[model samples]
Target: MSTDPTRLSRLPIVQAPMAGAGGPALAAAVTGAGGLGFLAAGYRSADALAADIAELRALIGAAPFGVNVFMPHHTATPAEQERLRRYARSLARAATRYGGTVGTPAPGAERDDWDAKLALLLAHPVPVVGFTFGLPDAAAIAALKAAGTLTVATVTSPAEARLAADLGVDALCVQGAEAGGHQGTFDNPDDPAPYGLLTLLALIAPETDLPLIAAGGIMTGRQIEAVRIAGASAAQLGTAFLRCPESVASAAHKAALADPAFEHSVLTRAFSGRWARGLRNGFVARHEAEVPGVYPYVHHLVSPIRKAAAERGEPDGLALWAGQGWRLARAEPAADVITRLVDEMAAARKAHA
Candidate 1:
């Protein structure tokens, strides 16, 4: 492994910056194991993000790391809001139990403190900063570059990949349709352009020379190598690491992940307005087709209900995101997970030889 930014095997693995589920401890653990880790500043206050950055520095010391930022999103039109409200009412039963009604909340200036976060980065720049959900345009990218930050943006299709590459980002986190959490759709969330990891890697390869980190349904060393063989520079894994000790996943999420009934995964817009693949459950089954058109607006509305459900130990009402490869995820220390992955990669290589 060399000090090259344009290569993959240089580190062997890189931790996916999973919003809500990722934290400093998981990032530090990955970095400590000779893999690049990332801090996800998607849904946090600027002060909170700064504190997280400070804590990560203290924890990882000299290990290289990165931070992920959610692209600023605007409110949907009034028609869309009404449409989402109509959809939210379907979850009324679950909300009633928590003394709340779904879809009644309105989204008001729910920016994730972009300016303050940018200022903080300017004052204390990390090695890397990644953008998701959408591209940050040319100006934001330049500002981040001026602050000595290597920029990365997540894209699903080659069309999006080319657009991001042309935006002058340092790298592209090409997320596949099977990826967990938010879909990161730059355009409308309803118009989901599903593409598998290998196909996406291949599609983007012919269009741009930017470094690509493949994500989605990545579970084993062989799967990682398959992405590399398909033209990805590196593999970014999240679902495989969900069970890691360093991860901040809740008990309900962990329990559902292990449950055989939740083994099947589907792309649902019930949790968030954007589509994300997760362990199919009662909530998803009930509201998949009735979902609204807003992005985080609907998500913001139901978050309280979700929070209340978690507090009440109601797994059926919570959002449990997982990839198709949930069956292979193991509950172990993060160090062990990373070590075992590297070992498996080495073994696979030797076996092929």
Candidate 2:
């Protein structure tokens, strides 16, 4: 089989694996539209992930699709844990307003069910598997390759790209700083590289022979063409699909993306302990300065409050993750979004040619 990642789909577009926003319906819709779609396995139990995979397969049949998993990393230190606890305490007043209570800091035990999910993928053998937050070890990579899975590693820097290349990954999803949700900086989640998607692609392309998939702040067909010209084989977009009808994003989240009042996206560790870009809201404004770098701990601490906010349909309290070009995202069907992107990309390329 050809190792070319682009060959997996008829279109050069790839729907990003956004944990909460993306699901089987959205994935199937994109794949059915001739683009490669991805089902995010982050924040899901092994059983839930298996169900989603089965559902996606049932819906799309043999259409090419992918799964993205969060590679586990231990980022919380003792000092960070103490700071997280203090931050949790500070949020008591806000939590009380939503009838929610912050939880105690527990970092080490959270694996996001990595082992079981990997075992499931190995046994079932998906078309493509991508990792974010960090790269899996060589043994895991070899095992997945042995199972006929095309493995992709998300990288933000040339150094990280080199490490992934050494492990022989099939491709690199070069995520830039402007990407929505979490920045996939494996070494230091607190401090991500300041480079843009095009710049990161420039830096990483010469370092490895792996196919590159550009992600972050890419919403228009022109932007996709620009990335392809810069050396990416494909473009991966998350926020552009958040408002699609097939997306599983919360109503508050979808509304926030279109609300002119939300104004701008700010990269903050307020919602999840790790750095993520989201539309600025009251919660972000109040807590961005005080939040610690203890991921999953702070993530758990803020869960109930976010849940309550979501239930109440209050955009101010929920994490409204979006890319910089969020203003360009439209409310439409997932298939329409894919078709428009593909059409636009062709037009853009033709105009340049």
Candidate 3:
């Protein structure tokens, strides 16, 4: 079976899997609208992920969808760990303000439950499975293949794309620098290359035969058509779907997307300790410089603070993840968003022709 991303959906649109923002209902809505919806398995236990898969299946029936899991690769040395500890100490004042304590992460506590999630997928396979943050091993890829699952690896550069291709992934989601939320930079999480989606696609298309799904700041039909012209099989969008009614984005988050006071998005590791693009907020402005380039460690350290901020309805403290095209995001149904995108894409293609 071919793992062509274009063939998975009637429209060449994919709703990018956002950890907390995306849910089964959002995925079902996109799938029902002839685009591929995705269930994000990030930040969820295996049991929770399994339950979501079942719910999505019930909602969308046999409509093809995908599941995205964060590929686990924690390379935090003792030095990095100490740096994370120092970073935690620096946030003590802020933690006090939030009425929370930054707990010291135990050694190897940053694991994202990769093993259990993989086991769950093997037992009950989905149509498409995507791995982000890092690439899985060949055996893992083969296991998903044996279960009739189309495997996708998210890549940020031509080098990453080639590495994923060598691992025999069915497809590649070529994410760019402008992408919101956490970047999928597997090797060097600290410094990511600043390449736009079209530029990265052009750089990667010549290196691999795998079907390429372009993801980044893509939002409108014109942007989708632009990527298609640059050799992308499809475009994956996250922020555009964020305002959809089915999205699990907090009410504060939804409002922030529309709030002009928020201004622009910036790539900051203050929230997760990895380079992720999001709306610049007070937390980012205050701590981006102090953030250590450690992942799940910093993620765990700040978890309580973020949770407290969310509870207090303070957008400034929460990670307002959004791409550059967030200004164009509209509050509508996911299906309507897809329909409008398809129509806009058609118009753009026709205009270009």
Candidate 4:
């Protein structure tokens, strides 16, 4: 597959797509600066996503932008869902501490309004597209390509990268072991691919010729150039962008991101069923073991309590997602940060020379 014509060349950087962090302004800023930015649509509904797209258009002209969708899974059975409900109830004391009540999973499951969202994207096609959790079926991917959307799928291993290449994706996002949020593992959430980006690139280079985008604990420009030399076309960052002024991160989330107290993060299914890395705070420490492999179930189990905690500034109950190199992050203008990252990469290459 050929590279997408609409992709950025001025800057070989992708503003890490962040969910719930004012996506429109961040994406528009990055795109405006000649790099790509993406909005995380994981927890958003179709109507909300449509509104976000409108906001993005208002902020940035018909410039290139990307929206990432989390492929939804079938919800667990009633009993299983109920079990999650009981699990939420078990956290009552913690909820009360934040002046919140635990919530039950809504009565039914929604596909994150997949068909409608797809229809919306097809109607208002963005310049770039990516999917996580899982790739949409071939028919869906084909539809996006037909509408002129450049497709990229995130993968954790060389085997998965080869699968995306064979399936005809234009590029692959090689997310290494240290990435925050979900791991994009095609297999089990618990069974994360342990390979770091350097090792992953070495393993994948021989398998597929697809252009790669490297992601993980890529803090400094040195790490970015290392990935570039290791065979990636660009680098994507999440934790680094969490503190940007344009981000929609809550005060609590931002505070946690800057907090020296929360020194480490772990992969936990306690917040969401999928394995995600985040600051090792009160919540993960208390319940990671109790969370079941059942996703929306575990996700449902913790939704209410998380919200309650957030509403009251209780960081302990909120999901403070951050990568390993989060401490290296600095608060700055999104565009400046992007420009700096490009310069840093260049500097790293120069120093080596």
For each candidate, give its TM-score against the true structure.
0.93, 0.96, 0.96, 0.93
Query: For model 1, how does the per-residue alpha-carbon lDDT over 58-135 read when each residue is reduced to its tens digit?
Result: 997866688888877786787986786676666787688765556554434345677788888878888888888788
Model 4, runs deviating above 4 Å: 107-110, 191-193
Candidate 2 TM-score to native:
0.96
Better of 1 and 3 by lDDT: 3
Shift in Å, residue 148, candidate 3: 0.2
Query: Which pairs clash (backbone N, Cα, C closer than 3 Å) in model 3?
Result: none
Residue 266 lDDT in model 4?
A: 82
lDDT of 4 at 110: 35
Can you tell me which runs of candidate 2 are displaced by over 4 Å?
Answer: 75-77, 104-109
lDDT of each: 0.79, 0.87, 0.88, 0.78
Candidate 4 lDDT score at position 274 = 75
- In model 1, the Cα lDDT at residue 241 comes to 83
User: What order do you get sorting by TM-score, best first?
Assistant: 2, 3, 4, 1
Q: How many steric overlaps does candidate 2 have?
A: 0
Clashes (N, CA, C under 3 Å) per candidate: 0, 0, 0, 2
